[model samples]
Target: MRRREGENREATNLNVNSLETLVTHIQVLSGNIADLTYLSNVLKQSGDWLQSEQTRLAPLLGELNPSMHSLGYLYILEAHISAPISKEQANELLLSVARFINACTAEQIHLAPEKFISVCRRFKDQVLLLDEPLRGVAPMLTALRKLQTSCEQLTALHPEFLLLCLLSKSYKTGLSILEDDIFDFDQPHDLFLYCYYGGMICIGHKRFRKALELLHNVVTAPRLIINIAAEAYKKYILVSLIHLGQFSTSFPPYTSGAARKYLKNFSQPYLALVESYDTGKISELETCVQTNKDKFESDKNLGLVKQVVSSMYKRNIQRLTRTYLTLSLQDIANRAKLNTAKEAEMHVLQMIQEGQIYATINQKDGMVRFLEDPEQYKTSEMINCIDSSIQRMMMLSKKLTTMDEMMSYDPSYIREAEKARSIFDFDDVDSLPLKPDIDAHLKDVSSSYDIDD
Candidate 1:
């Protein structure tokens, strides 16, 4: 009996020791997988090797123990390859892999919720590559709910995540979540999320100015929970400018930051205006300008916005122009009426300074208006040239003809000419007439400097 009991105790100790050994091996594997992540980071450095290694590891992930996190680590490493993995294949593998992680996470929750959280977070990191299925927004709403629950359970402080959830919810509903008064703005972290979410919601609702203000606050927030917040802020500002109907400015919608990756895609909607406005192509401008006119007519400050749009486009608005005002500055000011003469003047001056408008100051009235017409200006110059040339022609004809007549009949002039002819060789032939080469000498002298051809 004693020997049997001792053997049983020894066997239990042996199993625990073996489990420790397994954990150690899993940790080493995790380190190796981390090195693989660096390869993914330097994609251009070892792309071929990384791809082959990724392919080799895909099948091995299924056999790893979830508690060890080897499987989760491998899945994430594969996800970072930057090449398109088959979505269907990724979906199948990730769903099963995520489920395994979830089960292991649930088991570990009581023992250490932080570990479970870490495991669950890895699924999110990898699965972001998956395209969200197009549905009636139910899946996104549900996902937001799940994320909220997870955030609560895991004690995560990711402001951008929370903001995205609120934004997705608001976009899906077409209504403000803040209207229900569920938001707690006193909490800095929650406030950060609320502002970002509210801003995005405003964008969807086409309240671009409001959205800009909200995004600005979130952008300057001291504790940014995500690296992309600054970029998101810039995009929001640009989009707001577009929403406000400013399209002539050179400020594009997406430039640097997180938007740099998606700029190519985000740029498509504004391409027509970009080409038209940038190249000064009148036909394209007409089409795009018309589109913006129609869009802003539905806005609350339609009258004021319409005038500004017309002035910039030199006709009625048609399509929305992503001009700088609409895309960058207008959103910050909301859709407030820029109707006052003073305000309009300031706006026009700003446009002029931006080289979008050309204006001249009327010193008499202290007013600025569009620069003078080119054709009309040329005509005025031509009129002045013709007037000056007519006066000069009259003076030249009177002086030269009067001088010629005087010399033709002068007795002293005839006697001197006769004497010179006698000395030159016989008073033969009439004294050579002194006719001036007038036309040739006067060819370049003009009485008028007119622009008319």
Candidate 2:
């Protein structure tokens, strides 16, 4: 029994030694993976061999402790592989990659911005291709934001990288950059692309008005790029339908006539849909959608078109409030082309709840009453407008005050102002004769005359 116990102890030691060896191997592999310069050199030497090397190293990373630096490098290497990788193979790795990026120090990102940005761009493309809801988008965006904060030069070099990162639910980051005019792009396409992404981000956050403004910028760029303008025009039409219940005829006056003509041709389906909606005829709109179903689907605009269709009843119902103080549910149903009085009542109720209409419902009488008391209807809105104006003024005042303080304390500005004042005084001296020292000048003249005598 003692002999057997000794043998078991020897087996345990052997296992311990094996574990240590495995850990050593993991450390070596992780270090090698984290070396971006080394990986870049490998790719430069032989791109084909990089893939197999990455494949071999990837499984070993799984065996070791998960780390941000190692995961980030691995993701970059994987993206460099020439062959298309399956989403299933990439999904788990991508989650780790996102976490690693999010946790990276500003210094680390600054040290290796090219590698960091490459990972971000590749991850964005992969997520888009997967056609899945972005799961770790926020963290990835945070990582990109950190990189931008640390090294603005990266953004100047690859504005699209930061722009794509902002497209992934990073509206606050995107908006801050836009408001500050932080990006400097050498190419016009970059500016258009920035506006395009900014508009989409606004749409995601339900800031429809802001979205329209950004899209308008893209559509009306001075040197209009047709593809960007066409795309922007599509969004502009949909957002207009949602915001105004019809298409807008007023486009930017500065837009070229030729560009306007091309947009009209490109946006025919949307124009038809808008016209159908404007007629206040649900059947016409439905028929129009059905007829252009193939076109809408081909343009990938069916979803937006359907939203416009759904809003048709609301517009029709709203019209009735303007004409009638009170209307029976059945009348509303008939007028709005809804199937039943019950459906009409529900639509009205929803509109009322949303403050779209100043109206109340009478369940017993099955009637809807429009609130016609101007005071009651308009007072709250007036107050809200006043409050909003005050808030805006206060914000403006604060900004101006801050500017004044900055200017007042600027040493260089003060020095320049003093220099300008001295120059102005000298100019005044030059313009007007100065009074001479009279006594000294008279003595000098008398002495000169006495010497001559």
Best by TM-score: 2
Per-residue CA lDDT of model 1 for 237-345, tens digit only, reads 3454455444432323432233333333434434444455444344565576477654333222233333333443432111222332222223212222334445444
lDDT of 2 by residue, 1-453 (tens): 978955753453344323234334334433543443433333233434435455454544445443434433443344443346787866765675676665555543454566666666566556655643245455554654676653222252233433443434455555554543333344555566667666766655557788888888877775565655676688788778876787776566777555666777888887888888888888999999999988776665566677677678888888887899999999999999999999998889888886778888889999889986345536888889989889977977887788789979999979977996787531111111121222232222222211100
**Candidate 2 wrongly placed segments (more than 4 Å):** 1-96, 126-133, 150-191, 197-207, 223-225, 256-258, 372-453
**CA lDDT of every candidate:** 0.42, 0.61
The positional error of residue 243 in candidate 1, measured at the CA in angstroms, is 11
The number of clashing residue pairs in model 2 is 0
Model 2 residue 1 CA deviation in Å: 70
Report how far off residue 81 is in candidate 2 (Å).
Answer: 7.3
Please give the range of 10 consecutive residues that has the lowest summed lDDT in model 1.
Answer: 444-453
